[model samples]
Target: MATPNYGYEKRQKELAKKKKKEDKAREKAARKLNPSSPGLAQGDPETDVASLEHDAPTVPELPTKDG
Candidate 1:
């Protein structure tokens, strides 16, 4: 079996963490540049506007014959 290199493993972990932090910063900057970019909203008007106006559906009444 090969011996473990504790120092090398620790450095590798630190490098990974640094890369992750840099990536998040870049993403935040990109979002700042495009504030109005199309994305998921709380609610979309075209698909949800009608449903919002109405509640429960009503059943049609049957007609009765008069004597």
Candidate 2:
């Protein structure tokens, strides 16, 4: 009878799949618990700049001379 050297390989793949499923479930539960989380939402910096267009000045960068 031949011994199975690839048994651990199969066990590792099964463990990886289980871990991924668990992580996804945890994320789903957290989002359900907190729908208005700041990290999950995107911020619009452009809107803020647009509101302050007259007060905000555009500065042009001067070319640097290499000695």
Candidate 3:
């Protein structure tokens, strides 16, 4: 019969929590540094422009009399 290592498991859980917290802090710092990041849920100017261009309707050429 193997005994459960509760101490090791607790330490591992703590390390995971710490790592998650650190990663979240780093992400938040990055977002703060770059306000235009897509993660911020704000409209990006370049994205807006691209969407507008993509959605723009194309004009059809008229047939000329010589055609």
Candidate 4:
């Protein structure tokens, strides 16, 4: 059986991490340029939660039907 090449695996992991960082930086720059874009807004958790709370449908805590 061939021996595992730890160095190759480590390099792959590092490359993947660097790529992820670069992609995130690019996305952040895009967001800054287009802060009002809907596509980017959905990616943000803060706005998601805030919008959810602000726009949540009414819930009846108690029954209001006629007796």
Candidate 5:
């Protein structure tokens, strides 16, 4: 008959928790350094979308856009 090693399991869980916290801290620091990074962008910026203008079309004015 073998006994369960609860202590080892508990230690492993603690280590995982510590690792997660450290990773979050590192990510926060990276974001602070470059907040505009698209891959890690979170929430919207302070700029107002209403202030933006569409003076130009991205794709050439389609010849048959009216249709």
Candidate 6:
């Protein structure tokens, strides 16, 4: 059998990591350029929930036996 090519494997891993980092940087830059983008707002769960709650119709509370 042939010997394993360690150098090639290492280079492949390094390239993958670099690509991931660059992609993340590019996404961050895009987000910065479009501050009002809907994608950005959806990132915050709390704010999204709050907005939904505000827009949702209110329901009347039922009376309890204690009252």
> Top TM-score: which candidate number?
3
lDDT of each: 0.71, 0.71, 0.77, 0.79, 0.69, 0.79
**Tens digits of lDDT, candidate 5, 1-67:** 8999999999999999999999999998886677567754344333322223423436766678678
- For every model shown, the clashing-pair count is 0, 0, 0, 0, 0, 0
CA shift of 25, model 3, Å:
0.1
True lDDT of residue 57, candidate 3: 75
lDDT, residue 23, candidate 6: 100
Worst 10 residues of 4 by lDDT: 40-49
lDDT string, candidate 1, 6-56, tens digits: 999999999999999999999878865664546523255543434556746
Q: Model 1: residues >4 Å from true position, as ranges?
A: 39-67
lDDT of 4: 0.79
1-67 per-residue lDDT for model 3 (tens digits)? 9999999999999999999999999997886677676654445554444455567677999999999
lDDT of 6 by residue, 36-63 (tens): 6776576475545456666767799999
- lDDT at 57, model 1: 64
TM-score on alpha carbons, each prediction: 0.52, 0.48, 0.57, 0.55, 0.55, 0.56
lDDT of 5: 0.69
How far off is model 4, as Cα RMSD? 6.8
Q: Work out candidate 1's RMSD over C-alphas.
A: 11.2
> Where is the poorest 10-residue window by lDDT in model 2?
41-50
For model 5, the run of ten residues with the poorest summed lDDT: 46-55
Task: Rank the candidate models, highest TM-score first.
Answer: 3, 6, 4, 5, 1, 2
